[model samples]
Target: MTLVFSTCCFSPFPPLHPGRLTVLPQEALVQIGGSIQLNCSLDCPDGTPQWKGLDTNLGNIISTPTYSLLLITNATVAMEGTKFCVGNCQGKSHQGSTNLQVYSLPDTLQLETQPKELVAGQPAHLHCSISKVYPPGSLTLSWYRGDQRLESPDAEEVADDEELFSYDSELEVPGEKVTEGMEFRCEVELLLPPSDRSFHRATAVTVSTKGKSWRSELGILARWVCNFSCQSHFPMSLAILVCQG
Candidate 1:
């Protein structure tokens, strides 16, 4: 009996498996002085994952068997960029990336009225200013009156620099439209990528008609009180008393 010689070829290392790679927060909006964490995960247990496009010295990184974490503290404009995660599974390379948008938003909005005295039938101006905002190009200014949008002015050009900047916007209102106890609002919007954030400041002005006497002003005040009383559903007698007084 003749036995045919058979030979089998085998390798000591197990076959490599291809697995899915995922990165969380594909797009992030990190406010100035805030922090963010990004995660990179791999399904293939044999894969080695690493971070790219990140300064290891600036941020902290945590590595585990199946995932990696990147922590950014005190995010600022310098940290705005794309970050990548590269993984090798079964000798094949895979990459996942996330976009970081670091922005500075004004903590407060200031609204000021030109000319201490607001008079009816004359043009008046409202100035809105927001300070310490980064990426001023993405900023927008809007004027509103009681939920009514009066106008949206284009953002003025500002010098691009590492330091934060300030912006000013002005609105001119016809005196005829300015009434006693009129509320004007200035809204600031940061049109950042992924989503937009906004803040607003409002001021109420007491306007007097041109050439109006003190008695007329007092009457206007009384009428305002009466209107408030009526709107509050106070007793009709109280409303009448407010106007009479």
Candidate 2:
């Protein structure tokens, strides 16, 4: 690899030795809320390296006679950028930089099913929603039923707020496949493990085929309620009840 060096000079530092200055890990990729340290060392002690950035929030800096260090504790997405350590090298300014990138996962995953109850031979709509995701356009959402992959809607992304995103994956089920006791789920995939905010990535909702028929069950429930309504304090007409599948 071809190695190129830069010369940077400032009035505050004395003339530096004509030698090499190396900054470990020229680039850094860290998770949000994580910490990282960038080290800059000079071959000769004639000059001291200092860390600086256009933004003060880039992090804290520590300097010693031996080396200069940039410490970013509790790093946030806003702090991702290039930081520099420059010193006067042989009457010229020599510089090194650290490129930092921050990443995070969605805060919560949710699954929604249309007409909460699923019946055999009934068409149903299921949707998976991901909220508070960072670094948009890096998400892939897929749908699954048990061990089988289901035909899912194209995952869509939306800007929820500045620097935050929301995603949705929709799946439409044909009535023939609609059956009770089948679990459907959605997952948000990440490129690496220890992903930021990644947890219980999937949401599963079971399909139900309870009750012989929706029409009959509603009639039966209504009749059963009215049978004792006159005797009961609450009138059946004024009472509302939800049937369990």
Candidate 3:
């Protein structure tokens, strides 16, 4: 007859909580035509989660609680904005969002050749030209020979008021003591402020030496003449040869 007394002995169960999404690399500012990966994770393992892109219907549902959305190929300005992830856990739903920023970079870069190919004991000139750059900054040009930087007498820089810059460098080929058919490289760098997010372009050339000896040629000619004279017997040995003084 005391059934009401049993209700006072039972404890109430706790309410279910919703799932959450955590993203690594919280903020991203990347250049266009680059790649990025957004790692997302859910705290609970109840149901499959889905990812949605802002202003687009590109949605993907994954079985695992943790997933990575990769901009595997290339990124553009159009790819910037908020991305979202929605999931359900313990009969409750949650969502998370992230913002992306995209930037543009320089386009054209080339090396102007002054003796594009060089030999030892020779002088060479190299110049780098950059086109289509924004927010002009200081430019640095360097000459490298097989991973080792070469010293130059003049490191000249020229810039236009409209955000274009160029650098010219003159280098002398090292003597035989340091020559080994090495590779030479010319590099151009655009210096950015505060963060040093510089962009670099480079070109390389091969260095070699010109043949400077006639001894090898004379030896081959002598061998051919001796072989011909031995085969012919028409008084070839009777002819007298004299050397000039």
Candidate 4:
């Protein structure tokens, strides 16, 4: 019995584990006016988390373990870059980052042009074509006369496929209006949700009557040619000649 009395001691301690930080919108390419959200979460039970955008050098730490950083109401090209989130647990630090890409909207947008040079007091049609849009979303089309916006009764929107969206407008120029050398514009806008930013594309054509007579003559000649031409040939091949003429 005396030999068996050896003392046994035990020590109790919790296992150590590493902390983790996560960011959302992991891979994104957004328009200048669009926005995004970065959510930061930590695995550690006892830690304060902070979020920072490395490009802007802006950040904040909150008492709550989880934190969210908003891209705000609108974003610009200057805001493009990597954003970081950090979690500190008892002096131990863990960090994560997400890359952001911002693109510039087109300055002019248009698909088809009838009577390329618009004439006053005449009906004109402009087709707006928006193509190669990333992150498929809803779109809006608008027409402008100089700086003033125009209302169209025959404006129609059509999505040709997943990568293309278009709108056509039949505009009636006021009979008494004189729009010499004035600019007529077409604008296309793409909308994204959870963000205040909109992608924009626009195209402008100069108004002139100098070429109207020539354009009409060309149209008459085109009609005559088409009337006699064989329909068996590819429509695109003939279209190219008409467009070039």
Candidate 5:
């Protein structure tokens, strides 16, 4: 009688790791009509990576086992949105995302004096306008006189003639600060996330009347010399002496 035994060993499956997906340039900032690119990576050596958001068709999309890339060209405000990077490994999925923000600086910034003339003790107006702006809430208008900063006023919505937005605001001129020739500067700032852009524009308004012009007074003096030979030792009459000119 003979006994025979057979044994076989099987290896367990490796752990599943979708891996951590990383998106380069966590956030993107692009101006209108410009373009941007985002890089993506899945740490796992065997993971499949892909870009899942934005206008993927705008540019080339490179997908490899180690990394993926998304390119956006001729970008517009409409293209601004959340972009995602997705990866899969061992039937599990992992992902990460970034925000694409698109903005435009004011097309035309203008500062003007309403009346184009200012007078001490008289109220005048300073006007600031920002045209062709995007992301409505980003526009801000500020006023300044010389080296001093003035208060900010509520911005008024100007009628939009095109697809973009326009904003304007007026500040009452400081009668006390008004001078014969002085410039008032208006600064327009577009407060975008991660940055702030500024544009300085100023307009000078001359005072209609120079200061102290009304209260100015003048006085005249006349000097007269009369040649008179006093008679030797002659006493001149008091009234005649006083009248001599």
Candidate 6:
């Protein structure tokens, strides 16, 4: 009697995987006219994988059973946003996303001056104009004297083209604080994605004080100190006195 094989008694269920999805380079900061590449992977991949939130026509994309790659060419400010990819893992759909930020910086930073001569004790005006910057909202302008931060001024309101914008800031230096040969610096900070970057321009003014040069003043003070020290320690060596002077 050929025993018919007992009907197989086994339950089939889909694999138990979290279906974790990952996107490499989750955040990117790219200059305008640059390119970016992103990778998406899924755990226990199953079916076809695809990309979303970006125009496929603008990028080169490769898909596989477990991962997908996307390379965007000639990136522009309009393409700055979150991009997503979807993958199938264990019969379930998994998705991952990355953030893209595009920015531009001026080739040169120039602080425009109103007067040819910056005289001490005179109210002076300076203007910093930054052009062709993306996401202008992330830009800030600050003023500094030597290593001391003076102030951070609000950007002047301007028409936004949505692609590129210009920032203009005007700073007024009070005459009372102005000193001859004092340096004033204008710094621009880009609070873009990934990190913050800074650039600066500096200027100085001339003081018309009717007094001996600072060098001469220092020399006189040095001589007074040397005389006092020599008198306190009488018969001090001339070489030591000269060294102190």
lDDT of each: 0.75, 0.71, 0.58, 0.62, 0.69, 0.71
Error at 198, model 3, angstroms: 10
State the lDDT at 134 in candidate 3: 35
Model 2 C-alpha lDDT per residue in residues 1-245, reported as the tens digit of each score: 99976566436567645656778776577767889888987666667767755556666778875478888888776887777777765566678886776767755688888877766678888878876666666677888877898766678888854577788777888887776677777888755323343334666887765655667878787666666565688655454552232
Where does model 6 exceed 4 Å of error?
1-19, 151-153, 160-162, 193-245
Residue 151's lDDT in candidate 2: 65
> What local lDDT score does residue 71 receive in model 2, on the 0 to 100 scale?
82
lDDT of 1 by residue, 15-88 (tens): 66656788988777688889999999887886767788677665899988678888989987788888899887
Best of the two (3, 5) by TM-score: 5
> Model 1: which residue pairs collide?
none
- Which candidate should be chosen as best, given lDDT against the real structure? 1
TM-scores of the candidates in the order shown: 0.70, 0.64, 0.43, 0.43, 0.65, 0.66
- Candidate 4 C-alpha lDDT tens digits along 209-240: 67667778998887666655556454856865
Clashing pairs in 2: 7-93, 8-92, 8-93, 8-94, 9-93, 180-209
Which scores better on lDDT, 2 or 4? 2
lDDT of 3 by residue, 18-43 (tens): 46676645665566566777656677
Query: Residue-wise lDDT of candidate 5 within 76-165, one digit each (tens)?
Result: 767778888898866779888888888776445676775665666666787777777777777777777766788876787654544467
lDDT of 3 at 189: 71
Question: TM-score of model 2 relative to the true fold?
Answer: 0.64
Worst 10-residue stretch by lDDT in candidate 5? 218-227
When summed lDDT is taken over every stretch of 10 residues in candidate 2, the lowest stretch is 191-200
Query: Whole-model lDDT for model 2 versus the true structure?
Result: 0.71
Runs with alpha carbons beyond 4 Å of true place in candidate 5 = 1-18, 53-59, 114-123, 158-163, 174-176, 194-245
